[model samples]
Target: MNTRSTSRFSRAALPLGIAAVMTLSACGGGSSSGESSGSDTDTSAFSINLDDCEDPASATEPITDTFDIGYSAPLSGPVAGAVELATAGYDARLAAANEAGGIDGVMIEVNYKDDAFAPDKAKANGTEFIQNDGVDALATFGTGALSAMVDDQNAACVPMLYPSSSTADFADIEAFPWTTTILPLATNEAKFLVNLIQERYPDGVSVGVAENPTASGKVQGDAFQEVAKEMDLPIDAVVSDGDPVAAATELKAEGVEVVYHGGVTGTCAAFDSARGRIGYEPELVLKPSNCVNAVEYIAAGNAADGIELGAFGKDPNASENEGDEGVAMYKEQMDAAGVPAEIQGNAVAVSGWTQADLVVNTLEQAAASEEGLTRLGVMMAARDQDYASPMLINGIKWYSTPELLTGIDGFRPIKWVAADEEFVPAGEIISIRP
Candidate 1:
């Protein structure tokens, strides 16, 4: 579900045919003053080399009245599930934003193409969105879909506002200045998870990691291992290749006291089911943020009861949260937008709504920046943000800087109670930054 929308409200605007261009003096993107963390007003933080940027003069000559957004992601493949759910959230947010009056009275439009999770197809789609469709910004769903095309986006100087993966690669604004992510950084999640375990079980618990074999999964799994080692925490076993049951059995045989499955929702669900089938209950089974789902885990099996999760936002689907501000906004907006009633019970769409809101907010901020509504201005505005809303837990602040690329530094710990079919807050929100 989503929140807040009207049917494209109109605002006063300037003459429409002038092309938007980037100048160091206009936006202060060429200077080097705000490299340090949390530089909220650092206009010079996002560097742009015109030569490296794709035909900014021709590709974006005479800015159009409508702000076009294009997405390249797997719409027809196995991995398309999450993207599809996120799309619903994105669409809901876009509709709501347009309803609330799009940036400067200019309407926002979005187009999506099926990349089937292929890097090559994703690259082609990204190029088409720029050279062909003249989209104001580009968005890609997964890491593989964006890997082959992000350089092109940066070369063209187009802002690829939040590519849904958290491999830490997007944090390198030096290489991909036009890219940013609303997703919690994999590195940050790993560090926080390790620290949480260490702080709770001071005597030390045997940790085992179930690493997902995919690129993004490997990145997250590797981060977990690295952080665990840095904290002098030893892993009892590591399993990457095996059936879910086999992996669970192996970890149990190792006498692992805790298991952290750094994978997507489905993988985490499988691991939980596998553990339960054999009655191999560890002290805790920590799953990454991606596993914050209502149906997936519970449907997998009742073993999901004790599964600990890292949450970047409040749970909209939890029944007890019916009166929460974010929850009400999501349910009402989604219902208003005619999204299925079932989606209100799933956190995936809520995650999508959060990401889309980030994009909407970024565009809104960029429109008001000193450089005006140029594409370069969008990147500059996005590079430094202090986003606060009822969408996140009360004390958690989602911000970004040239130095601190990770947007959400902390996550509130959550526990899934299959019996109640909801996520319960376990403890205080943990911030790894300090």
Candidate 2:
């Protein structure tokens, strides 16, 4: 979110300016209730029995060979640090898998390209990866970029595995069967935040939602509003994409106690700056999927202190997670990628590793299938999985099914302890699904 700070990913050469815009219409409406769980009978594309893979009778012979996995993200430009860290997770875990003799003796070779966080470039990279590179599956980041290519990826039938986008529509299995978003849905995140307010601020809370002018941003703000209304929280203030200082001033005047940011990383930092300038401090919460790059918030000096976030994974700065295997894998990968020691464990990096872990795990499942490995088989393997990775909270698992595409249903609420310089879990992991 902080423009000045550079994570390991920004070390690459500056790229030429290219831009593209995308919008998601299917994701605007928030879910009516938070009860989580998923349906259906589409098994035409997959040759192997989907049920058999759930608990295969005998391990199928996996093709012991090298495989290509495509990766696309903004490797340059303003948000490069977070985007790069996401892919760095991919690189780290893949390296670990390879060192461990790969998934079922098959090596994963990630073919990466810099999209500059531009939608057009992402589409180009995706096309090349699917058509020319001949990758079995693809991994990607960014909501706008992924939204732009849903039709194309679905047409190509190449599984788009574990993209970093948190847009709800990316997980629409019926609409785009070939892709799966690993992050929690934006609407679900809004509900969880509202639930947090109801549980923690039970003594009548006044809330404000900071939103960007874009359609996706509006959808996020609307979601929070819907949930806040359902939970009976007082909505006293609202602001759109404009001067952060003005927005902060108005919210403070209204005595707002909590601010739910429905914008991107820059918008979050801007609000932090404004709050610092106006001395109007409130509980600042950003969309968990995008807020993982807390390094951006921390870069705002002391103004970024005490920010709260919801996550399916541990914060890189959380000392309680020092002994975590996922944390260790993250560090090893960052060091392997030559990331500076200070920049290692932010949200982006943690997410990268988690997503890569999902991909490799599914690949292993697909390889063990009696029908052997194929793109559709790999995609089908991701359905109805209850995956427990190193980064998830101890008891929670990333669960999925044919009917529900959102992989994870719960998030741990964590607060940034500026004094201690680490994120401490504020509450237990809350499950929204059944």
Candidate 3:
């Protein structure tokens, strides 16, 4: 877990603020586990049938005639570049869908708000999208902001689809009924990192966590703590701060041999900065959100020779397999959009595209609902729906239930190879324990 950066984007304007506030006020809105051998009746043995669209056999009917989708993210924050990439994927998908004749001729409209990675701001914008703009669902990014608005969205019965938060608390389907995530939960990432440590350094592992004070950070940090205690591994130090350099220094003093970062790209930059100041560097483990776009981090002069990270989708930077439709589509759209090819594979864009697809699918389902297109109705339709978007990590499936919409069970580890300046796959997918 690493500290969150204090840097703010210079381009965000007051108009964006007013729009977010207005959106929130207007709608009045207000809005995994291991495989197990079990009996057929066992809950763990159940799986959704993706081929089942609806009871009326509307699968062949165009879904576009029915509804619209909307989203809000940090389009103007420190993470904007990544956000833009994700949105581009969404845009391309939307265009492709439209070109193919939208779901039943119901055109999907995507409205986005720039929360700038601020939780309070996201909450406000979320409320506006639900209440004022009349968006049937929301696709959001960042953990802190989504957590901030969970209560409102849940109470309002607005389906918050494909939020980018991977925190365990958010994965508790029973607690937050209206929200779902697209990536493997952060708790899983922590578990995978710990498992890797145990296998590689069986003697004794000195673990360090750099965490932010936000809800997501705390959940991931707690997971690491629990696993270390369970395994009886020596916990070097768990540091919480907004400053990465200072946290790194403290971890170094603690003789930390393995570091787990809970923050995003900025935290990686901080770790890089700290590495420069001190002579020592530890094996780094990053959260899914932090690991995407390693080239930029490396180019910034961060030595990522021994870094490993958990990933939720196919790494764009990784070598592509022949006829990989998702990767091919991503590259085509990114190039056409004039986005630099280097940043195509980053997690931010993949997340954005995945979330957008969720929105699109939810809207398609909602249109077929007999209850019409109200937020609650749309959410109900989305509940328990199953679909595999092109952007999910390989061999990972996206699912949702009435109580919990995101899958918590999947994640893979990736190790950064300095020679290629890319993250190479490390191991098979593993589960995150509760």
Candidate 2 lDDT tens digits, 1-434: 11111111111221222111111111111111111121222333223332222212211222345666777777787567667566666677777777878766667777677887777888998888766665666766667778776677776667788776667767667667677887677778888888877777778677888886544566677778877787778788889746778887888888888888776643456677777888988865545446646666666657778777786876655668778765665677668766666656666667777787777777766655433455545666676366666677666677776667656768887776666666677778888766
TM-score for predicted model 2 compared with the true structure: 0.80
lDDT string for model 1 (55-97, tens) is: 6443223243777777886787756666667778778877877
Give me the candidate number with maximum lDDT: 1
TM-scores, all candidates, are 0.87, 0.80, 0.76
Task: Estimate the TM-score for candidate 1.
Answer: 0.87
For candidate 3, report its TM-score. 0.76
* Model 1 per-residue lDDT at 21: 39
- Cα lDDT listed for each candidate: 0.71, 0.65, 0.58
- Go through the candidates in order and give the clash count of each: 5, 4, 34
Model 3, 363: alpha-carbon shift in Å?
3.9
